[model samples]
Target chain A: MARQKMGGFNAGSMADIAFLLLIFFLVTTTMDTDSGISRKLPPMPEKDQEKSNDKIKERNVFVVLINKNNQLLVEGEPMDVRLLKDKAKEFIDNPANNPKLPEKKITDIDGKYFGHTYFVSKGVISLQNDRGTSYGTYIQVQNELAAAYNELRNGLAMRTFGEKYKELSESKQKLIKKVFPQRISEAEPKNVGGGK
Target chain B: MSKFRTKKDKGTPPISTASLPDIVFMLLFFFMVSTTMRQQDLKIRVHVPAASEIQKLEKKSLVSYIYVGSPLQQYQKIFGTEPRIQLNDAFATTNDIRDYITSEREARDEKEVPYMTTSLKVDEYTKMGVVTDIKQALRKCNALKINYSTRMLSSE
Candidate 1:
């Protein structure tokens, strides 16, 4: 057998292949993932309500809690996951319990509320979760909260105008949605307090 | 010369036909074993409030965020780089939030028409009142979507 002379090691070829593989993986991967629950947040307030101190103080508020163990607490007491929707509805409707009708209002040329502005006010939804809970559990809670709000909002629209929420007149629905509190504030667990 | 000077090997040393395949295989195997798969990464940890009926949002940007923590009440700040305007200050008397949103909208670029997608990242121990106050502020933005950020559960 003839002895064969070995050539120089081809470092460049190995380098090229490695680089190509690295690029392939980088491009193929998906960069973003769902943080958890997806929700359609309510719009910001309109002009009329902008100056009413009275309306701000007396508005309805809903409270939700998730303990370190991932257990739920509505208001102050522990609650079953099943009660989430009903509880949300109950809280949302608390505002409408008031007897007074929405006040009358006059607007400027830009449709901005000039005088006293009236809106069907939906109260705020307050959420608080413990530090130790998992993200999945948190998302679960959020979904429930939104569902409760939607149910309450749609129910009000149907009862008040005798029409489905989507089919109702835009102006009328807008009025209804504004008063309906779609805002959610995540409270600190320390202040969640004792159950009602 | 002793038996014809041992036949000298000619041409290029037997081209490493197997070397390329072996190198490629080793490279592929390394990546397959060593590459870490990306997963959901949440900036803040959360234990979401549970509900029976769950629905996904149509648009991701529209969802609002509210973060809650014990000491967070005193902090009164937004996470990351976004500015912190206290919830109480924003929603204090009347609808001050409405004013903030309007100003924000005006300052936003006209071309993008960025309909301010909003959320509040609250601390876990935040007071319900403060949350309410913040929510009150968000109501002023009139954003179409609202979502709280949370981490994913491990399969274990």
Candidate 2:
């Protein structure tokens, strides 16, 4: 009787096996990341709650309407989409202290703007779109509105903290947000015009 | 000339492939970790609109996707060219959203139910009527947190 020793297992094919697995993953892998405009829809109104009409002043509400033709009507006036951000920013900030823009409430935020009462805009962007409006146009309008708020917050953060809003400490960011809160109120869509 | 001739004769000593597997394994691990496998085959064509102000959807495990788009060419005969909602792998109507939400909620940890987000990956060209219906359905089901899934638009 003779005992036989096993030769070293061939690892020459190991590379081939790994290559196969690598190719499989490559085929199945989806590299695109998910990103988007996050929003919180208002909770369904109770039967009684729907009847209660807490009126918002006309000056404080910046009405943005999009029609089926993708036309932009801002505050009852037709405006170009390119001009929406600046218009929104002006409505929110009201740097000139214009009486026509949204009224600002003086609040002591107790931060870098300490002791000084900062005027927080009490503005609400009311967005209403026709049912037949294209999703692309709707998203574009939403983007512009969001960008307006972001720029305002960024400007405030830079002025107070000398940094971007995203770079600031949580509390500091909160203060800036308190000054320029994102208050986009989406109204129920209406069939203002016809489209498929 | 003599040095060059000797080096050529040795022929680079077969260029050691001992680490070939290691290299391939490294690449394999990278792909495995950095990307997610395609979860469902798309039944419709969805070209998400581009937006300048966008936030990355965080906590992917707590996110569920609802696709809204017109049927692809092959599906047009059966599903028609009209835009429709696709939940999971099957075509669904707005009415089916509640059940879908319920099932999706039940699939996750109870504590995480509140944190769950419904991402709407709707086509850009689709009319808002269908999207509005989806939103209303989601609102009724109390799935308030939503992300309008979009790509980044270059700032002009």
Strongest candidate by TM-score: 2
User: What lDDT does model 2 reach?
Assistant: 0.92
Best by DockQ: 2
Candidate 2 chain B least-lDDT 10 residues? B10-19
Q: All models, DockQ values?
A: 0.17, 0.75
What are the runs in model 2 whose C-alpha is more than 4 Å off? A1-8, A111-116, B1-15
Clashing pairs in 2: none
**Going through the candidates in order, what is the number of backbone clashes in each?**
53, 0
Tens-digit lDDT track of model 2 for B35-86 = 9989799999999999978899889999999999999999999999999999
Q: What is the C-alpha lDDT profile of model 1 across B42-109, one tens digit per residue?
A: 34333344334433333443333334433223343534332223332231222555664565557666
Candidate 1: which stretches are off by over 4 Å?
Answer: A1-60, A95-122, A160-162, A167-170, A189-196, B1-110, B116-156
Fraction of the native A-B contacts that model 2 recovers: 0.89
Model 2 lDDT, residue A127, Cα: 98
The sequence of per-residue lDDT tens digits that candidate 1 reaches over residues A3-93 is 3456556565775676678668665544433353445544554667766555433235566877756688777788987688777766665
**Top candidate, metric lDDT:** 2
Task: Estimate the TM-score for candidate 1.
Answer: 0.39
